[model samples]
Target: MKPVSSECAVGIDIGAGSGAKMGLFTREGNLLGESLLPIERYGRSPVVMVGELAGALRDLVKGSGSPPLIGAGVAMPGFACSDGTVRCNNLPFLDHVPFVPMMEQAFGLSVCVVNDADAGGLAEWSHARTELLYWVFGGGWGGAWISADGQVRYPAVDWDGDDDTLHYSNEPGYAIPLSRERMGVELASLGGSWEGFERICMAEREWPGGRLAGPNGRLDCVRAELFVSGNGRWRIFRTLAAADGYDLARLTPEERQALETPSNAGRVIDRLAEQGCPVVRRTDLMFGRALAAAAEFHFRSGPRGNCPDGIAIYVGGKPSRALPWFGPEAESVMRARRLHASLKLSWFSERNLNANLAGAAVLAWNRLKGS
Candidate 1:
């Protein structure tokens, strides 16, 4: 038999607001060459964007001087269906766009379009071939479940709400406070009343500030998830600030700057922990437990219960990468449940900064192999 060609593939990660990044990767997940272009460089025109992306891909392959490119993969921030239609709220240009066909035509290769979060999950699963629960904690929180065979379960079943993204702010139980009558019983054991808690939250006097306070705050409808890194960190900061001894003044200008823009919040929280703030640890623990609770909730009611055991949780994005303790903290929460399944945590970048791209390439490589 003629030996099969061991050619490389191309992967493109196109995230909203971050422009486009393309890379050449061997089937083994090694990044061979990479290139980038700011989204604005294309003037937000789809035709122009695809043309620019195609040029970048050509440059990446040519620059690498690697094997023939066999396939291509594209990752973007949006809801992409297997049929190639994408509904992107963040990348308005991609709304109802058939990006797969566009890329395929541009590059003359089989192309796959996947959600950015699912791309991360695919990368993690490729490393272990285990049941993977990968969460990307960047601008916002997103998660994907992969079967042991590396099949990603898409269109994650929504949890008891109209919201799509999984964050505490949108989760039913955590989204708001219980009613006054309901709170009486809920808080009776804790020796506090719902009314009292609402007062503090409404006054912005304590934990659960205006965003999570008042009857209006407590009974608000589903809001958009905080996909912005700065917003996510601000949420963490406010939650931690509620606890006693949290020195708000210790915040650096950079840290404070994160609160105003969409940036990595995990790094700031980790820095605060390094600064000797006990509240940071406490908040991390809370956040970790919240993640566990989300997992448990999904296992019980969501669509991920089938492969509970052998599950590995991969954490990445700017924040989780900076905070090494994030995994353990979340693991502690998962273990505390004493459930049927065991979970493990690791970084998505255990291989490279181009983990998403690596996974996209892997998906394309696998597609070619299957064909």
Candidate 2:
């Protein structure tokens, strides 16, 4: 362990299943030390979770020679508020839990909290120092937008859980509605059906906010995530392959096993795309089109030139790694629509750093600098 100075910060990225990832970073955003406290260690109780996290953080700082902490920033999931209370459906134990104040008290340092997506966006800003859109595709699509001046724009702060209350800029996946009619046409072009895709989605969790709404409030659309995230991408591959009469039964045992597993399907689809599989190519193309629509809605809602032409939309999460396949089509469609937002792989990811932890470090650095 090296002796760090006062220009150090602690970042806490709390995830579902009571997992907490803590990192020690220099003011320059370099990760100095890192540790994880999994659910198996802390269980599901919020009190125990915080207590376990506090000890882990203390050890993280102490192991680094206990440098004078600049501050601590938490990248949280769900509707996290400034008062330390959070309404996280994934980590239901966090319901109304005063995480901010508790961590501050536990750590004896200034603390700040933000939504994990916003933290990822902030991490992008930390590296690029430019206005950017940050989208992470996983089970759901989470995103954020940072201004040219490093201010987070339209953050999902203290969301009241109202469908209309969510802005496309912040909650792009959930707020942006992909026109059902347009999607149906696209699916038909590939010999697929809207009903089939919807069936795949409904077989799992029901759509949040109920039936989607389109232009003029008409219920003729679907949530953008249903066609954008990892699961959605997997769904696209399955539905398209099934429609094109590509029988999975013909695949090797390993291939079928990979695609059949929901958690591993997106990677399998990406692998198939890499092999130049027509069905996989078409699947990503469909996803690219969906992204184009969401990007248009996202850029238009923000201030002028915030996402200027050629500015990269820095992305994170596992699915973002496949941007090389789907990105060109997305950028192409966006350009055809006169939108110039370019999609790029996450900067932090390329360096093998967790975006959430990096972003939390950036948040703490910002808080320290602002003071």
Candidate 3:
């Protein structure tokens, strides 16, 4: 008797600003292969996007030697709707588009969709099956809450376009506010300036993408994302340098220029932090504090009865690769505040898995099993 082939799933991660990644994975979550589709290939045409994505999916399935496909799960950088539509701000072309159904219709495959950040959480949940916070630090901080039962709690599916209505678990960076007064205190201790930081924020802040208001539309505080993100960390570095009088003797101008690249800045900061550069160390400390501040609000005001006291925060995203530098400080501060939660590097990170794609695969497999 011949052995039956294992069933696989298709996982597609769509980045609004970037492009799309498609991967084939077995039921056990091992990736068989993957492909990339550039945004330019699809452009703004929904028909084109769907056609290209269909080809990619077919290629993945064919490349896997005609293994039975469980289903397809798509991850997007936007809020997902029940009717297979997505509201993507960055990819204006995809906003209000029935993206999931389009892809499914094109390829005649069962398909599901989820927010990218939530997808990352599902990836972690697939491993731990516990209540946790999944936070991704990029240009903006994105997040999700996974229940102990492996469901995404408080997903932003029904968002009304008001930042204030978003739940802390679903949008911690946008809904949580780091205290301005506390920031001033943190800055003063390290010879940094709150005024200078504000100035930089004002100059760099983009419309609609950033908000000066805090949780519930309070004006006295800044959204946690303004300081806890990739570019946000760079802003901290810039502000501290200007305030404390940058010591170029320790870091060359060329190195300083390299730090301006968000993709490369985390590595540079990690190296400099290891070398004990005062500014880099202090900047990380400040960033960590803001991160703690977000967590504090989440635990204190979130669905406390549902989650355990020591809920783990699984960190994701390229920027979070620097968690080894900032996570310790955040953990320490949370401990000092008596918040029992721990800041943990994501399971995806430890396993060297691409969080979005892996998570999408898990989601697809689960849907196929009627979970």
Models, CA RMSD each: 6.4, 2.6, 2.7
How far residue 323's Cα lies from its native spot in candidate 2, in Å, is 0.8
- Report the C-alpha lDDT of model 2 over 1-371, residue by residue, as the tens digit: 76767568889898874488999888777777899998788777877777888889888878877787788888977877766688788778778888778877777888888889999999988888878888988887988888888778877678877767776667778777788889988888877899877766666565545544443355778778878898888888878887788978767788798887567787677777789989988988888988887788766765521355556788788888778888888989999999867788889777767888888888888767662
Ranked by TM-score, the better of candidates 1 and 2 is: 2
- Per-residue lDDT for 1-371 in model 3, tens only? 23327888888999876689999888777887799999988999888999999988777677767677888988988898898888998788889998878888897889988889989999899887778889888888989889888788887685788866777777777777888898888888877878888877777646443656676668788888889898889889888988878876666777777776665677677777788888888898888988887787777874532355588888888777778778898999999999888888887787666899988988888777655
Who wins the lDDT comparison? Answer: 3
Off by more than 4 A, model 2:
207-218, 301-310
For candidate 3, give the lDDT of residue 326. 86
Report the CA-based lDDT of candidate 1 relative to the real structure.
0.59
In order, the Cα lDDT scores of the candidates are: 0.59, 0.80, 0.82
Per-residue CA lDDT of model 1 for 9-28, tens digit only, reads 78888877668888877777
Clashing pairs in 2: none
Which stretch of 10 consecutive residues in model 3 shows the poorest summed lDDT? Answer: 300-309
